[model samples]
Each structure stands twice: as structure tokens, then as C-alpha cells.
Target: MLGLRILVHSIKLVVRNWRVALRISSPLIAVLLVFGVFMRGSIAGVATLGPDEGVSWLAIGVYLIAQTFSGTWVAVAWHRYVLQEDDSGAIIPSFMGRRVGAYFMQGVLIAIIVGIVTVVAAAALFFAFSGLNSLVLAIVLPLVIALVGLWLFYRVSPALPAVAIEEALSIGDAWRATRPYSGSILVLVIAMAAASGVFGALVELTVESSTYLYLVLVMVQTWISMMVGISVLTTIYGVVVENRDF
Candidate 1:
């Protein structure tokens, strides 16, 4: 019940401060728009050359690098603004340097660790259940793996806010800080996922079949979701780690 309250409070916080959310997200929106308009054609051209082609690989690399930097910038900015009450806007000139790189590297490190663990667990399950029905294994195993991944992610998520504030936090520190609130974190994660899924379904059902329109709607949905996620995590971090009142 406490977890639910925190989730509700987080949602209210984001909705109540919509202007701040928009200002913080504006830089990301602008960057995405520019990339879509200027680089999409070139990337698409390279993609048409087939997956095995050198130009295709180049395009993928470029896209990934751009996404990593842009995503890190947005996440760090949101964390700083919401968690620290830093009034600095989305495009803080000073944040574009080492701070952005540190944030990006931290994310990459966490992702790599989570990916490895998930892969290893799935492989173990496959071998251990060699005699299980193939269809059941195929469907159930992936869901189980996904749940485990989500659990692991929540365990270390506190480190992300730590990085945002330039704090020296290890994975162990984050894991332990969140241990007391694990139940609440689980509820929040599941609730957020369900909400996002429903929102996407509604968009699919009501929107016209125009590619550009769909893309725009999806981007908007993503931004809103991002804001909610940051808010929830920041709130949790403040309450659990810093002993701050909600």
C-alpha cells in the first residue's frame, strides 16, 4: 500500500509540475526532431543496402551513438532538475561535457551487467528444463527472464540518481538502499508497465494509419512515459535513500 501511495504521489507530482517536465524534455524533443528530419533519409538509404553491408553497419553505429548521448543527456537533466531541484534547463551548456559522458557510461555499464545476467539465467533454464514442452518453454521462459531482468534493474536503479547528482555510489549501495522498499518498487514497476502498454494500445486503436502521424504519437508517448518514470524514481530515491518526506 505504501508503494502504491508513492507511485500515486509520483504521478501527481509530474502532472502538477507539467511545465517543468516540458521544459526539461524540450531539448530531447528538439534533438529527435532534427535527427529525424536530417539523418533519417541517409540512414534509411544505408539500411536499404542490406544488413551485411559496411554502410549498413556504419549507419547503425551512428544511430546508436547518437541515441546513447541524447538519452543520457535527457535522463541526467531530468534527474538533476527533479531530484536536486536544479532549475537549470534541458540544455545546460556545462553538462554537455564530462557529466554527460559519466552518465552515459554508467547506463551502458548497468545495461551490460543486466543483459549478461539475463542471458545466463535463460541459458541455465533452457538446459535444466530440456525435457519441458518446447512451446511452453519458448513462451514462459522469456516472460520469466523479463521479470527477473526488471527486478534486477530496480535493485540497481538508485545508482542512476546517484550518478545524476555526481555522487559516488556503487551497485551494492543502491541495492541495499532499496532493499527495504523492494515490494513498493515492484508494484510501481508493474503498474507503470501496464499503464504504458494500455496507452500504446489505445493509440494504436484510435490513430490513423499514417506512418508520420504514428511516429509522432509514439514519440509523444515515449516522452510522457519518460517523465513519469523519472519522477517515480526520483521520488523513491529521495524517500528511501535521503530520508526525505514525499
Candidate 2:
């Protein structure tokens, strides 16, 4: 249950330091809000559709790029604020261009690794399940495949916060560090997936009620998700890498 303990503790880190978390993320939140308006429909499960935010391909592209920058910046800043407790105390977190670039690079590397692993896992699982052809299997197979990916991602995600803190850690290194926590991580992956799916469905029901409310809920969810995600990586890095106790 180490992973569950870590998840709960990580959440407390964000909640206890909620003000600083907001300060670290607020600038990027503003940036995302501005560019987010132009994004239409759901982009990776979070809805961005709005009253006048029509379908613009160019706007979507720009918004995605802006989102990347803003996300990286906030993640790096938050890691520092959590680990280093940086003393600037400014309204917005300090900008670190090189760290942001490095963070993006590491993210792309992780994505590629995760993508390949997921694809291979999918192919294998598809072959394994192909002969069954039951309706229940059809519904459950994708969930199983997705859990595989999430499990793998959690195993190596320590690399992300390492990059944020200017530490060098390869995917292989992170994978090795997390070896003992395999069972816990799998349980954590399942719990996280279930929670996210339930929350996303709850928010999706609001889409037709009021566009503004939908937009607000979606952004708020994204904001909290991002912070909690960063905290998770930070927690993992602290526990397995730095040998810090919660």
C-alpha cells in the first residue's frame, strides 16, 4: 500500500500548501484560460468547448503549444516550490527557460517510451483476447490495456520530477527504482483510473446545462489534476529516489 500512502500524502502536500500551489500555477492558469477559449471539443478528456470558441484548426494548434509551455513551466515551478521551498514569494513563479526545455524533452521521451509500451501491450492483449469475443470482454479489454499503460507510466514517471529538479534520471533508472513497488503501483493505477473516469463523467453531464459552467468545471479539474499529478511524481521521486520518508 505504499503507492496508496504516497497518493494520499501527495494530495495533502497540495492541500496544505494550497495557496502557494495556486500562486505557482495561477500565471499559467491565466495563459491557459486565454488560449483555452479557442480550443473546441475534448482534447485528451478535458472539454474545452465554449459558446464562441468555434472549431479553428490553427487556434487549436496554438492552444496546444501554449498549453505545453504553460504546463511545463508550472510543473517545474511547483516541484521547486515543494522541494526547495523557493523564497521569491512573488505572485508568479520565476521563469526558468532551460529547465522548461529540459522538462519538455524529458516529457517527449517518456511519451515515446509509454507509447511504444502501450502499443505492444495492446497488440499482445488483442491477440490474447481475440478468440473470446464476448460482449463483456469487449468492454473490459480496453480498460485492461489502459491499466497496463498507466502501470508502466507510474513505474517510470519519477524521471519527470527528476528533470524538473535538475537531476538526471533515465527511464531505465526510474523503472529500477520502482521495482519493489510494483503491486502497490498497480493498485494505485486502478484506483486513479476509476476516480478520474467517475469525475470526468460527472462533469460531462454539465456540458448541456451551461457552457460557462462546463468550461469552469473542466478547467478546474484540469488545474487540480495537473497539480496532483506533479505532486505524485514529486512524491515518488522523494520516496524511492531520495529515500525521504513522508
Candidate 3:
């Protein structure tokens, strides 16, 4: 029930803030689509790569930069908007500033931490149960580890909104604050993963029909996933950090 509430509230936050949301997201979404179109070949090639094959570092770097910038820009703006913390009072959100930079850096740090934790957990589980592994276990183990990493990520994500609002929250602070709510956050993560998987399965069902339709659905899903993911983090931050009513 807690997870369901988080999911519903996150969607509502996006819906209620639709005007400012669209205003800030439009230009960045255009940029992302244009970038995707230009990099379509390389992006598509990623899925077809052999075990020994690798993508070009340059292409990967460019794509990551574009995605990270666009994502952080929208997140910072949305956080400020929802918290009533931004005094910019502009029609659209700001793209360049200290807040975005700090958010980006902190994001990178969090990614590193999550990656390290995931790797360590996977390794530990692999070695500890080396002789008991089955085909199903092989497939499930990594997925479980990834989900654990995501749960940990959410537990520490309040620092992001704190950064946006210039509240000086450390990563440790965020983690400690949400310690008791770990189970709730895990529930939220599972619910989100289930929802995304369902949406993706439906989209896959349309892939055989029309390429245009598949592309449109993919873009829409991507946009919704991005916004809701940010909103979830923002909601968690509000409830935990600001003691906002859930």
C-alpha cells in the first residue's frame, strides 16, 4: 500500500505540474530526440554487439553527456517547482547554473556507489553459491542484484532534491533518514519495476505492427519513465526530508 501510494502520488505530482513540466521539458526532449535520431545506428548496434564487441567511446560519451545534462536539468527544475523553492519565476526552467552542476556531480557519485554495491553483491552471491547455480538462478541473480542496487539508490536519493533546494544534505544524511523506511522504498522500487515491465511488454506487442507506432510508444514510455522516476525521488525527499504529508 505504501508503494502504491508513492507511485500514485508521483504520477499526480507530474499531472498537477503539467504546465511547468511541459514548458521545461519541451526543448530538452527535442534535443534528446534529435540526438537519438543522429545516433540511431550506434544505439541500435549496441543490442547486436557480440560479447567481445564494444561501442565507440566517443559515441558513448556524447550520448551519456546529452542524457545526463537533459535529465539533471529537468529534475532540478521540477524539484524546485514542486517545493516552491525556485524564485526564478520564469516561464521555463533554467538550464545552466550551479544547481544543475551540483545535481549532476552528485548524480554521478550516486551512480558510482550503486555500481560498486551491485558489483560487490553480485560477486559475493556468485562465489558463495557457486556450486548451487541453476539456469534460472543465473538469470535471476543479476536482476535481483540490480533491484537491490535500485533500492539502495532510492534510499540515498533525497540528497538530490536537497541539492536542488540548496539544503546541503549529505549522502549519509539521506541514507540515515530513510533507514526505517527501507522496506517501503523497496516496495516502491518493485512496483515501479513491475509497471515499467508491463508498459514495455505492451510496447513490444506493437513492435511487429508499425515501426512508427513502436517508435512513438517508445518515446512516450521513455518520457513518462523519466518524469515519474524523478517525481518518485522528489516525493521521497519531500516525505522524508521536509516531513511533507504523503
For residues 1-246, what per-residue lDDT tens digits would candidate 2 score against the true structure?
A: 887888888889889999888888976688657754644343422254422345456655666677778889999998888777764788888899998899899889888989898999888988877888587477888888889988998899888888888888898999999998889889888877777789889988997897767777877777887888888888888888899998
Superposition TM-score, candidate 2 onto the true structure: 0.90
| Of candidates 3 and 2, the better by lDDT | 2
Each model's C-alpha lDDT? 0.71, 0.80, 0.79
| Segments of candidate 1 deviating more than 4 angstroms | 35-64, 89-96, 206-208
Task: State the local distance difference test value for candidate 1.
Answer: 0.71
Ranking by TM-score: 2, 3, 1
Tens-place lDDT per residue, model 3, 1-246, is 776788899999879877767776765676557644655433322222411124475765565567667888888888887886563656556775899999989998999998898899989988887777597468877788879999989999999999988898999999999998898999999999899889888877875786456656666776788889989998999888888887
* C-alpha positional error of residue 231 in candidate 1 after TM-score superposition, expressed in Å: 2.3
Poorest stretch of ten by lDDT in candidate 3: 44-53
TM-scores, all candidates, are 0.81, 0.90, 0.88
Scored by lDDT, the top model is 2
TM-score, prediction 3: 0.88
Clashes of 2: 0
Which segments of model 3 are wrong by more than 4 Å?
Answer: 36-61, 85-91
Please provide, for model 1 over 1-246, each residue's C-alpha lDDT reduced to its tens digit, 9 standing for 90 to 100: 766777788788778977776776676666556545554432333223433222356665665566566667767877787777787543332355677788777777888999999999989988898799999798988777887787778778878888888888887888898898888777776776678779878666533565456546656675677667777767877887788886
